[model samples]
Every structure is written in C-alpha cells, then in structure tokens.
Target chain A: MDKYLNSQIAKIDTSGIRKVFDLASKIKDPVNLSIGEPDFGFIPDVAKSLHEAIDSKCYKYTNTWGLSELRVAVAAKLKMTKKSDVLPEEVLITAGASGALDLLFRVITEPRDEIIIFDPYFMFYHELPRMLGANVIVLPTTKEFWPDIEALKKNINKKTKAVIINSPNNPTGAVYPERIIKDIIDVLDPYDTLLVSDEVYEDFIYDVGHVSPLCFYENTILVSSFSKNLALTGQRVGYAAGSRGVLMAMAKLQQYTYVCAPHLAQVAALQNLNLDISNYVSEYKERRDLIYDMLKDTFEIQKPEGAFYIYPKVGDGEKVALKSIEKDLIVVPGQVFSKSNEYLRISYAAPKDVLIKGANILKEVADELR
Target chain B: MDKYLNSQIAKIDTSGIRKVFDLASKIKDPVNLSIGEPDFGFIPDVAKSLHEAIDSKCYKYTNTWGLSELRVAVAAKLKMTKKSDVLPEEVLITAGASGALDLLFRVITEPRDEIIIFDPYFMFYHELPRMLGANVIVLPTTKEFWPDIEALKKNINKKTKAVIINSPNNPTGAVYPERIIKDIIDVLDPYDTLLVSDEVYEDFIYDVGHVSPLCFYENTILVSSFSKNLALTGQRVGYAAGSRGVLMAMAKLQQYTYVCAPHLAQVAALQNLNLDISNYVSEYKERRDLIYDMLKDTFEIQKPEGAFYIYPKVGDGEKVALKSIEKDLIVVPGQVFSKSNEYLRISYAAPKDVLIKGANILKEVADELR
Candidate 1:
C-alpha cells in the first residue's frame, strides 16, 4: 500500500529537526534547545480572554476570512507596526505562520515554477515549494548570513514566481537591516516577483526595530504568527497581510484547507493585541549575550541581533551535535537549515542556566571535534 | 496580480453555500438554516477541561502526530465504538476532518487520479480531490440518498484511486446501514480502491446505530471530528483511523501542512472523551422531526436519518432559496452539494422556534414556486 503514497510526499524524509527531537526525547533531562517555539507560555491575560470567549460560546466557526472584529484589530495592529495602511480585507487570520505559507504557496505555485530562498532558511521554505511542484533556487547568504543582493539579482528569471525573506531568520538569527531589505526588494521589483517575508520573530529584535518589506513592496505577503511572541505555538493562530488580490486567493484556499484559525486562539489574540513584549525581548537579549559571550572564544561565530538562536561555525555540525547529546545536551545542526554542515544552531530560548550549561557542553564538543 | 494565481485555485469560485451565507448575514432577523455545524456550543465539561488545560499551561506544540495520551485515548475509544482492534499508531489527529481529507488526498493523489463519490455529497468531497489534481467521479444515489451499489461496481477501474463514503451525510443526512456498508466494501474489494469514510456525524443518528466501513474493510480511512458531536466546530480537532501504512503517510504530510491539531482543542478532546451527548442528540432529533413533519405536506422530501439536515425535492433550489431569504429565512440550494439544482437542503440544527419559522417560510417558497 505504501506504493500508493504520492511520489512527492514519499520523496521527502522527516525533517532533520525531528530526528534531533526524537534523539532528545530518548535522552534523560537533556538541555534541549532544538525546539523552535518560545519556552514560556501565554500571559495570564491571554488565557483569561480565551476563557471568556469559551464562556461566551465563541467555539462556532467564524467567517472563513476570520472574525470580522479580529480582522479589523489585526489590520490596525499591522498598520501601526508595519507602518503600512493595511485594511481589514488585506489581513487573513491563518492557522499559523506555517499554514499561511502553505496557503500562499498553493495559491501562487504552478508546476516547475521557481521560488528563490536564501540559504540558512527555515527548512519549510525549501520543502514546501518543492512539494507544490516548484523548483527551489537556493541563493547563498554572506558569512554573516545577510542576503546576497547580487546572488538574488542573478537568480531572477521569467520562471521566478516569488522570493522568500525570513528576517530574524531561524538557525542563523540574522535580522535583515532596513538597508538590506530595501536592496533585496529593489532587485526583485523589476521582475514583479512576489516577496514572502516571514517575520514571526519581529518582536524579539534587540539591536534595532524590525523592518518589513510590506511597506516597500506591493506584491509582498507578510507572514507572522503569535506562536513565538505570545508563546501560543500550539494554538495555531497567525495572520498574513498582503495585497487584496493574493490575500483573497489565500483566504479562499484556506476555507478548504484550514477552515479558519482556531477560534479560541483568535479571541485570545484579539484581547492581547496591545500586549507589551519588552520584558520578553529583554530576557532573551540577556540570554543571547550570555550564550554568545560564553562560547565566543571557543567557537568562531557571528553575533545575533534578533531571535533566540546562535550559530557557531563548527566542522561537521551533526557530529558535534551528536557528541554534545551524549553529554545530555540537544542542539540542531546547521545542515538542517542549509546545504552546508559547518555550524550548530543552539537556541537561547531556554532558561539562562540551561543555556549556560548547554553552551559549555557544546563548547567541549567543538573542542573535542577539533 | 490575480493573473499570477495558481490555475487550479483561479478556476474555482466561492462555494455556493458561501454566497447564501453572505446574503443571510445582510438580512435582519434571518432564520438561518444554512449552517453545517451544530448550532449549540460545546458542553460545559468540555469548556471546564479546556480551562484546566490552559491553567496547567498546555500552550506548547504537541508532537506532530498529536498529544500521545490523546491519541491513545482516541484509539481506545475507536476500539470500543468501531469494534475493531485499533492500535494507537494507526491514529493521526488532524486540524479537522477537512484537514484530514486534505492530507489524505495529498498523500494518495497524483495528477489525474480518479476519486469516486456518490452524488448529493459533501461539497469538499468534490472540491478537495479536484484541487489535488485528481478527477472526481460523482455517482448518483437513490432518491433516499443511498449509495447505488450497482453504480459503485461500474465506476471502478485502474485510475480509480479511492472512494469516499459519508454516512450520516452532510446536506442529505442519509446514514448508511450495516448491510449497505458491507455491500459497498465488497464491490470495491477486487480493485482495492481506498475507502475514505467521513463519520463526523456519527453521534447524531436518530433511529439506527452507526455502521463504519472500518469494521469490515482494512483499506478504509475513517475520518471523524469532534465538531458536530462535541460541538467543537471552531476548535478544529479530529482524527483519522486507518491501516498504519496510510495513517503514517498522512502523519508525514501533516508535519508540513497542519503541523499539528490545535493543542488546546486536543487537550479539551482528551478531557471530554467520554462526554454524554444524549441530550443534544435528542434535542436535534426533535427538531429534525418538526422540520420534516411540517414540510412533508407542501413538498416532496426525504426525512433525514441523521446529521441535522433535510433535502426537499424543490424545483430550482437556488430560486426557492433566494425567494425564501426575502422573507428573512436562509437555506442552501442543492447545487452546492451536487450537480443537480432540484432540491433544497435545510438544516434543522437551530432553536425550535427558528426551525418552525424557517420551515414555514420554506414551505411557502416551495408552494409559490410550484
């Protein structure tokens, strides 16, 4: 019966992260940092709002586009944050940032269409377009993980349907500065290729405020989720803001796909629209400093300005990760996020003590491997 | 930008039911019978369980397969209810039954694969497979909405990848008896066509017990949801039970698609697994009787055995539905669910007074059209 499985699905293996997760589960009290979601939970106010929503019987299906009030609120929030005039119709509440990308890809991709992504990307950026029958063109980033504007310029062609930009990118934690974002957008503008900006880490930037391509590119679909910022990863609620043409197409695809974002999560988001995350940002910033300072001398690495991960240049990352795991620490290897296997992605989203212990173990492993 | 839309998504329009939903929302005091979900909300115990889950901080991602204990509970429940020796590994919790079908079709369908469905079927049974690039073969049912076993035999061929069975069906609400289910399974046994049974309405039968194809067929993927039975429609928690090979394939697809079912809903489902739904069932049963009894005199109709709907054989269903809506009543035309436009599908899952008013308005529209 396995022969009946779709060729596309059967061709892909389980994600590299899942393999590490499985290994972590088997080890006892491993200082796990392979997980992508926030280590904390939602604030009490968010839970209270959800409780009220349940009491008020908000468990029925909302509009396929999502609750009208929630959409309005999301539009307002996006407008203030992205500094773009986002209308309610331009915002679509999705199951999560992952769900948003799935819908966006389904709407835009045709067989053999080319989608360009920077190397050291979120893994799905590569897998999803391929599964949808699109060819993924991997453009290498600089050693510091900034988008290579020249590489992006050279990659565009008639078949290039879209280019993905993940600010505060996973694995590398390279938050694209405004100047880099503008340069990338300028390169793709003549081709009118769609820009998909994944900004789920928008709230966690430490050095500078976040920059979104939505403000500069009309063809951009900006995808973000509350999963990280609100610690609601399991709630599966996110939104996509884009031009009405593409967003409407996404909403229609969403009806048959996700139906709508989870009702409880949407309601929680509505109430916490004004949530202050400076405390979380500060906490993670301190951890980022702690881990980077602890490992800087031992391993050659770039200082991360956003998100909670630090990638250290270690030879045979999977080997180092495996060796580190033997000492009760879990971290993801860079090959999972890129074609290269020379670095380790250690998440600083864990507690300070866990980060401290995990960093020392990773450092020891790197030294032993050298 | 619409020119860039995927050809598959661009080819389809908004569903017929959605048009009526939009129309219904505009009118004041509309007696809406167009909803596909249970009108009531979740039971109190379910809410209490969710509250506890939130308080206990179940706000992180569960395993992509779903929460392990919930999967175990669901497998155990299926063993007793489905009367099959179901194993925990054979179950994959999904965002909803819709998500299950989406993943299932993605796993099984290749371009131009043929999927068979009985006419007067759920709208998605036609749309989802087509979106996956499969050709949908709609076989007509009897007047009472029973699968014509002879038609089943005729439709099977090398290209036929699967057959969908929705007992206690949507729109028509015909619950297949055990004998018919066994006969359908026998007809497709030779070709080994996969059976995708949507049993979301299993808990709503008024007269007879539910008979799942899973009890008799090993190649069946039984899809059911807590939406209708537990009144968690917006919660989007459901599961698929099938042979481990297919379920595993679906699980693999789920990692990139839905990621996982909403965590809070899974927690709620786990806590309320043994919820008593007899009261809600009996309430809907009475409303079903009331609508059928009232409308039988004016129009030729089949009494729905389950699933909160009745299809009256009205001429030009859309015209009747439109005329009825002017009187501030809402119902769906048959064209949404089937190729034919000769019937009206009225949901009886409303307050008794609303059902009474909607039924009378429907009768008047049918008479005026006649």
Candidate 2:
C-alpha cells in the first residue's frame, strides 16, 4: 500500500517528542517533564476574550494571510521590541511556530537546497526540511548551547539558503545572547541566507529578555507563539515576521496548506497582546533555579537563562532516561533531538512539587551513574 | 530577494476566489454571487455545542492524528455510506480538507511525479502538486463535466502517482454519476495511481446523492470538510479517510504542519454528527433552480446536477463579469478556472432575493453578449 508513497517521508522518522507525548499519556502517575507545554492555564482576560470571540461566531476563515487586525497586532507587538520597524505586510499568522516553519520551508526550499540547522534544535526542524527533500546541515553549538560563530562562518556559502536558530531554545533552554547572534549574522555577511528564528519562548526568559533576529538581520523571519506565555500550547496559533517578499510567499503557501490559522485564536491574541505575563516568566525562572540547584552539584547542567527547560549531561542517557521513567519521572533523552545520546532534556514546565519529585529522580539516577 | 526560494511557489497564483472574497466585502450593495461560501449559519445545537466545548477549556490540541473519538466519528460517518466497513485508524482529522490535500500530496509526491487533475476543478488542486514541482496533467472533462473515461485512460501510466477527482465540484458544479466513477476506476486498473476524492460538497448534491470513491476503490483517499455543510467555513476542521498507511503518513506530516484541527470544531462535530443539513441543501437547490430558470433561455447553460453553481456560456466572460459588477452584480469569469472565455461560473449560494437581483443583471449582460 505504501509502495507508491514519497520515499523521503518513509526515511523521515516521526518526532520523538510525540513518542514521549503518547508514552506519557499511557503511563500512570509519571511526573511528565517530557512535553514542553506550559504548566499553567490561560490568562484570565485572554480566556474571556476567546469565549466572547467564539460566541460572536465572527471567527470564520480570515484573509489568507490572517485577519487585518491580527496581522497589524502582530506587527505592532514586534515593532515595540525590535530595532527596525515591522509592518503588517511583513507578517503571516500561522497555525503554530511549527506551521510557520512548514510554510516557510516549503516556499523557500527547492529540493537539494541546503538548510543549515543548529544541532540540538527543535525536533520538527529536523524533519520538516527533510520532508521537502532539502539537505539539512546540522551545526553543533559549543558548550552552553551557544551558536559557534567560527563554525557558522565555515558553513555559510552561496548554497546556504537559510539558517534556523532557536533562542530560549527547546530542550537546551539556551537563549542566544544578542552579541553572539550579531556575530553569527556577520558570518552570513558575504552570502544571501534567510535567518529563521524560532522565538516561541520569548516570554519565559529569566535574565536577558528575548532578542529577535529582526534586530540584526534584514532577511530574517521571526516566528513565535502564544503557546508559552498565554498557556495555549494546545491552540496552534503563531505568526512569522519577515521581509515582505518571503512572507508573501509563505502566505501563498498557507492558502494551499492550513488555509489560515484558527480565527478565534487570532482574535483572542489581538485582545490580549498587552496583558502582562512577567509573573509567568518569574515563576519559570524560580523553577529553573530550583532545578539547577538540585542537579548542579550531582550533574553537569546548564542553568537556563530563559525558557522552561534544562539540558543535563548524563552518561548513557537512554539507559538513564529509561531508568528515570521507572521512578515515575518522564524525561526525554537528548539522542531523540541529536545524533548522540550524551544528555537528557528535562523540561521544568511542570509545577513546583512535580519539579521537585522529577529532579530527585534525576539526582538518584545521576548518583548511581557517577 | 526571492532568488533562493522555490520557484514553484512564485508561480502559484493566489486563488482568484480570494480576490472575489475581498471584493465582495467592499462593493456596496453588489448582488454578490462570486464566493462559494454556504449562505447558512451553523444550526443552533452545533453552535451551542461549540460554545460549550470552548467554555469547558477542553479545546487543547488533540492527538496529532486528531482526537480519537473524532476520528471514530468520521469513520462511522463513512461506514454509513460505503459498501465496506471503515475504521478509525484510516481516518486523520485535518485543519481542513485543504490541510488534508497539502499533507497527502506532500507525502506522496516526488519532484516531477505526474498527478492527473481534472480540469475546471478547485483552484487549490491546480497549484498544490505543482508547488512540489510535481507535473500536473490536466484532463478536461466532457462538455457535461463528467470524467471522460477515454481521456482519463489515455493519461494513465506508471508515472501517474495520483488522480484528483472532485464530485459536486466547485465552479463547474458537476457531480459524477456512479457509472462514470466506476469507468474511471477501471481506467486505473492497470496503474498504481492513488485515487483522491475531494467531496467537500457531498451534502449539497441536488439530484444523485454523493458517491464516495471509497466504495469502489480500496486505495482511495476521501477528504471532506465541515465547512460547507456545517457553515463553519472559518473553523478549519476536516478529515481524510483512506488506507491506514497513507493516513498514518498524513498524520505525521500534519504533526509539523497544522499540528491538529481546532479542538473545539472536533468536539462540536462529535456532538452534532447526527445533526441534519438536508434543509440547507434543499435551499441551495431551490436557489440553483431559480438562477438556471432566469439564464436558461438567454444563454447555453447546463443545469447544475448538484452543488450551488451554474456555468453559463457567456462570450468574453471577463468583459461580461466586469460589466455585471458595474450593474451592482458579481460573477467569476470562467477563465479564472480555465483557458476558455466563453463560460462564467454563477454561484446560486446567495439568498433568493440576492440571486434574483444577480441573475437579472447576469441576463442583462449576457443578452448583449449573445
């Protein structure tokens, strides 16, 4: 039955995150730090606005790009933070940051074009380009998950179509510092490369706030979601801000793909774009610090500057991860996100007590391994 | 700036349907017959169910393949119509039927793979496979818009990866009879091509009821949306039922694309699966008959068998369509759907009074052209 299917899709493995997602659902009483969903509910006002939007039934398919107001809202939010002015014409709202990547890559990539992805990035980034038959060049970040500028310089060339950088990154939780980001941009100085930034975790920063690639690069697409801040991960709604030419192409691809992102979500987003979420950021930071304290002495763990995850190096990660699961603590092994199994990505998006219980299991496994 | 982007995406003309959609919003008191949107709103029970789902805060992301119960619901719906039993595993709910097609062809198409598309079909189908650099073989149907068995058989070959057939079709509004469908199936007897049926208008058929490709072919992928039937065009939820292998692959692709259809839409669908829309279909039929009566004597017109559109032979369709708009009427030129300028598609999906006003204006324009 599958004989006539696209061979590349067969070669691309299903995401390991989904594997853990399904496994966590089936297992009983596991402290799940596997999935990256926020451990919070929707903000009060945002929830109210969404219900009102639904009641109105005004939430039909928006313009192929998005509702005019929502696109303007996205631009307004970006313009307030970025160094350069952002425009509605330069934005395309999407199903999620995931959907943005799907449309972006599909519009930009010809088969065999090279997309250089930083190693240990989001799992979908690993698969989405490959599904398009594009060659993915995985560049490993140095210690502390920093983008290695020299390595990036060596890789950038006439063939490099795009570079995917995730700040406040998934699993690793390493927020790319603005200085190094500028350095990486310098590396792409001689060639034309689209800088694609996944900034979905922008609201969860513990130290330096999120720096969009828009601040440094003209040819950049900044994609982020309300999934983390608004606690609507299950609601797949996000947006991409980039050059008008690229965004227009993405919007065209979107018409043939998802049609438009959920209209209700887009409306709610417009209503709550300014609602405060600093408390959520602070809470995530406290959890990040707590986990760092617990694992810092026993295991080599990077203290996350932002986002809700901490990547801890552990020998034989698969064995340790499986062993940790036996203790009713769910942690996704790093090998799932990379070519090697030297570390495990532990999400601190869980609540405090759950975080403590999961951290204790990690310490227990680390002590035994040491 | 687009030098590195896929050339095919540049070639994708954004749907002219959207142009009409936007224009309708602005034109003051134009008897609009341009868009194919269902004139009816969702029934009270379905609306209530949707609101209840939203208020309950259960509208989170469903399983990537979709909520299991929703898949089961879709399967059961298919079972009632098909000769053979269908299973939930063969069903993958999507953002819309648009999302279903996007994922399906992406997984099945290699570059330059020949996908047979019946001419005068949905605008998206023309652009989708071509976006992947897949060769689109356009087969013009007979004058009555039936799938010509000889033309179809001549196009069948080893390179043919799929055949896209839309029944109760858009624009042309031709619903294939079961005998012609069987003959088309016979043409595929020698090849390994997947039969893809877009049945989004299944419920709106006037004369002969909808015949799913599933009944005759095991390799068929049947995709339909709740948009037309439920009047939830903006809600972005639909399903694809096919062989387990293809459905599974589609689900994997969806995990990175739209992720899942809106959870609220799926929940509402579960509550209202038995809710009838036959009255809505009957209304469309009446409107269809009304428009046909007005134009039948003035021009060469094929009475629509099903669906809410009439393709009338009007000389210089673009010129007539433009002049019709000046008379405070809206009509889409046939050239938007095909090369020919002789026929313009008139949607009777408008209200009775609106259809009357629009049809009179159409007659005025056509009388001069004739």
Candidate 3:
C-alpha cells in the first residue's frame, strides 16, 4: 500500500506530554501530574448547563463561527479583563486552546513563514508551527522564566509572521509581568507581526494580575478556554478574539478545518462564562499555595505567580521523573518544555490529598536521587 | 497589517448551502427542508446516558484516539456491519463527520494530489478536497444517480489518490445498488485508490441493504457519525474505521488538528451504542415513507431509496429556490451540489407535518415555474 500519511505527520513527533500521560494510565495507583489539565471536576452549574442544553436539543450544529450567544459572552468577558473592545464578530469559538492555536498557525503562516516562540514554552506551540510548514524561532527566556525582551527584539524581521506568548507559562507556570508584556509588544509594534497570546490559565493566576498582550496591541489574537478556569477540559470549548480582520481570516480557516466547536460544549461554555466562577479560582489558589509550600521547603523551586504548576529544580530532571514513576508519582521533565534538564514541572491541580501523597513520594524520590 | 491571513484563505468560498440556510433562518414559520441533519430528538436513553456521563466526571480528556471503551464499542459495531475486520486501534472517534472528513482530506492528500468525486454529489465533499490543495476529478453519474463506471475508469491517473462515495447520498437521497457498488469497486480495484465512504445516513436506507465499500475494498476509510443514526448531531460524536494503516495516518493528523473528540460525548456514544436503537431507525423509515408518498403525489420526484432528501426537477433550480424562499420554505438548489442548476434538494428529516408543509410550498413553486 502507498504510504498514506502526509509528510507533515512524519516531521512532527507525537506530544511528549501525551506519551507520559499514556504511561501513567497503565501504572496502577500512579499519581499523575504529567498532562496539562486541571484535575478539578466541571463546576456544578456548568455541568447543569450542559445537561440542560442536551435536553433542549442544543446538540445540532451551530453557526460555523460558533454560537452567537457564546461569542457575545466571550467578547463581554474579554472586554472586562483586557479592555479588548472586540465585538462578537471578532470572536471565533474553537475546540480548545489547542484548536485555536492550530488554526492561527495554519491561517497566518504560509510555507517558510517564520513564527517566533519563547523557549521553555508550551511544547505544542513549537510543534504546531513546524507542522504548518513554518520555521519556529525560539527566543530563550530569562532566568526568571520571562520572555527575554532583548532577544525578542533582535529576532524580529520581515519574515516574522507572529510571536506566540503563553501566560501564565505552561510547564514553568511563570506569569509574565505587565512591564515585560508591554516591552515585548513594543518590540513587535514596529513590525506588522501578529501577537498570539495563549491565556488558558488566565483565571488561575496567583500573585500577579494576568497581563494580556491584547491590552497593549490590537494585532493580538488572544486564545483561551474554560478548561482551566471552570474545570471543563473534556468539554473542549475555547475562543480566539482579536481585530475583526484577523478573526475573519481565522474563521475562514476554521470553516475548512472542523466547521465549528462542538455545539453542546459551546452552550456549556456560554453558561460557564456568564456564571460566577469565583469558587474555582479560590479553590485552585488554595491548592497552589499548599503545593508551593511543600516544594519551597524541600527543593529549590520557583513559586509561580499563576497557573497550576510549580517547576522545581532537581538534579537530573529526567532521572528524578523516572524515580517519581517508580514511586507511582508522575511529573514532566523540564526537557519536554526546553533544553533545561535540571527542573521538572509538578502540577498542583489535583485534590489536596492526591497532591499530598504525590508530594511525599516526590520528596522521597529527590532524596534518593541526591 | 501585512495581511495576517494566508493566501489559501481567499481561495475558499463559504459553502453555498449556508447562504440559503441563513435566509431560511429569517423566514417566519418557515418549513426548513434545507438542513441535512436528522430532525428527531436524541433517543431518551441516549440522552439519559449523556446526562449520566456529565454527572460523572467524564469531563477529562480521553485518549487522543478516544476513550478505549468507545473505541472498542465502535470496533465491535463495525464488525457487526461486516464492512471490514477493524480493531480498536483501527478506529478514531472524532467531533463529527465534518471533523473526520477534514482530517481524512488533510492526511491523505498532499499538495496537487487528485481526488475523484461523482458530480451532483454532496457539496461539502467538493469543497473539502479543493481546500486540501487537491484537484477534484468529477465524473457525472447517470441521470438516475448510478455511477458511470466507464467515466470513473477514465479519470483514474497516477495522481488520483482517493474517491469519495456518499452512499444513501445527501442532496439526491440516492443509494447505489449492490451491483452498481460492486462495479464502482471493480473500477477502483486495480488502481492505487482509497475509497472514502461516507455513511452518515447508513441506518436510514428505506429498502436497500446498505453495503459499505469497506466490505469489498481493504483500502477503504469509512466515515460515520451518530448524528443521524442516534439523532445526536449536536453531541458531535463520530468515528472513522478502516485498515489499521489508514487509521494510524488519520490519528497522526488528528493529533495536530483538534487532538481528540470530546470526552463526555465519547462516553455518551459508548453507552448509547450498547442499547438497542431499532426504534430510532424505525421512526426515520416512517418519515422517509411519508416524504416519498408526498413527493410522488405532488411533484415529479424520484423515490429515494434511502436518506432524508429528495431531488425534484424544478425549472432553473435557483429560481425555484428563490420562489420557495418567498413562500417561507427552504430547500437547497442542485447547483449547490454540482454545477447543474435544474433541480432542488429537499430534506424530509423533519416531522411529517413540517415535511408536508414544505412539500406543498415546493409544489406551488414548481407549478408557478411550469
């Protein structure tokens, strides 16, 4: 039989995160923190909304852009947080942050177009750009896990189509502060480069205010989902909002891709957005604090200002990860995110007891490695 | 802003079916015979299964292929169909048939590959192939909607990668007879062509036994969804089953596209598949009978062997479509399905009352045109 796969399939590796996740599933009693999903259940009202939607026959296909009411709600939410003056026309609901990211890269990049990403970044971001036939330029971040603005400025050139920013950062969970966000935006401001900001963890920020590049730049496409904030990861509802011009382009791409986000999920997200989700925010913050305290006392770990992860420096991060696996505690090695192999990302999104058990196992593994 | 959109975005025109649909949505008390969706509500037990899934925490991401249980169920279902001996590894649950179709096009066709389609086919099939940078070789079926095997054989060249067959076809409601299907397969048997069978309406066939190309061809990729069969369109649960090779290639492509199908939907589909769905199938068969009787009495329409649509010759399909719109009835013109503008396709998936109302409006329009 002819090789049925496309060339792009061979070029991109299966996600390292997914590989570890699959491994964790087979091991009995494994405490998994490998995948980048919030461990909380879907908020009660969100689940109720979904059940109501299914009963209402909201399971049919929605408009290709998405459900209008959901788009309007997303626009309203964006307006409040980032001062983004986008209307519903400028929002495109997608499968998830992953879907939005893939669409953005595919629509914006032609073959050989250059997209810049900060290293020690979301691994999928790097993989997506390459899969779309674009060169991914990685500008390494500073020691504190913020984008190196100087490196970003130097990397900007005419071929640069977009620069992807994730805050709070995946794997590391380092939220970029406002001044640094503005600095990065200013550097790209001179060029006609689009800024792709993934703020899926926006509601999970701890000490710092979530800074949106959309606030400083009109050319930004802000991608987010209810997965993290409302604990609806399996629902797979997300949106990308930006200038009407950019969104219209993305919408056309989406029409050719998956048509629209799943309708039932869209209704659930619409309700999730409208309802008060302060309880989830507070609960996650408590979990983050507890995990941070444990890591700080035992290991050299940077306290994340946001997101559900803490990157702790353990000697030979991969070896530590393997040791944790032996102890039935699963964590991601730093090399999955970047070249750094001294640190591992430990998720605090699990229940308090699961986190406690995993943390104790991690401490034992670290001591054995030392 | 340097036109942040890729050149390919400009190449796609929004589906022509959508334009008529938009106009239909505005018509007060309109009889919508335009949408291709099954108009029945989800089976009560299926809805209950979904509700239970949501109440449980099936809201986390499933395996990228789908939930293992769902895959196993799908594989068993495929086995029952006797299309091909497929395993769980040879099945992938997708968001909908739309997602599966898009992924199939993406993985199978590289730039400049050729895909064959029967003219007067499902409109989306034409659009999707074009979107993938593949040139479509359209062979017009006979006036009675049977495959033109000679023309199909003539179109096969070194570049021809796949042929799309929508049995119990959309727009025309034509089901290829067993003899015709075997003839089409004979034409493709010698060539290195992949038969892409879209059997979304497999369960709705009135008189004919549905025979998927997979039954004869080992290289077939079968795409289907529970949307029509279980009336769960909005739930967005579908699957592609075929040879292990084709499924693996699609899985790699899906990993880059949307990752996986929604978790809760997969759970619902899994549970629903276990239940006897004879009642849903029987209800659709009744609706199909009512439409066939009405169309034969009211206008010059061929009795569709299967599916929910009937293509009736109306003087200048576009003009009849406009007249139907004026009378608050919505139907897709044949021009949307192909370049031919001589017929209109009306869906009979609605309740008998609604279908009768639409048929009356269409009859009036046809009489006026005559």
Which candidate number maximizes lDDT?
A: 1
Off by over 4 Å in 1: none
How far residue A339's Cα lies from its native spot in candidate 2, in Å, is 2.0
Candidate numbers sorted by TM-score from highest down: 1, 2, 3
TM-score of each: 0.98, 0.96, 0.95
Give a tens-digit lDDT track for model 2, residues B1-370. 4675688787787555555545656678778787677766556777788778766776457778888988888788788866646698888988889988988988898988999887677777888888777888888888888877788888889899899998888878898888888888888866857999999888888887778779788878899888778877777888898878888888877877787887778887788876878788888888888888988898888778887788988877878877786787888888777757777888887889998888888878777766
True lDDT of residue A210, candidate 3:
84
Candidate 3 i-RMS? 2.2
Error of 2 at B215 (Å): 2.1
**Residue B162 error for model 1, in Å?**
0.5
Model with the higher DockQ, candidate 2 or 3: 2
Better of 1 and 3 by DockQ: 1
Tens-digit lDDT track for model 1 on A45-129?
8889988988989989888788889889988888888888879989999999999998999899999999999888888888888
Find the 10 residues in a row with the least total lDDT in model 1 chain B: B10-19
**Candidate 3 chain A, run of 10 with poorest lDDT:** A14-23
Cα shift from native, residue B367, model 2 (Å)? 2.7
* lDDT per residue (tens digit) for residues A1-370 in model 2: 3776788787567655555556566677788887678766667777787778767775467877888888888788787877657788888888888888888888888778888888787878888888777788988898989887877888788778899999888878998877888887888766858889899888888877677779678888888887777766666788888788888888878877888887777887888887888888788889999889988987787788888889988887777887887777889988788887888998988888998999888888777777
Question: What is candidate 3's CAPRI-style docking category based on DockQ?
Answer: medium
CAPRI quality of model 1:
medium
DockQ score of candidate 3?
Answer: 0.61
Tens-place lDDT per residue, model 3, A1-370, is 3376667656666555555666666788778776678766777888898889888988677777899988888888888988888888988999888888877777687889999998787877877778778899988888788999999888899999999999998878899988998898889889968899999998877777888988679889899887777777877778898867767877776776677788888888887786776676687789888888877877887778888888888878878887788778899988788767888888877888988898898889877767
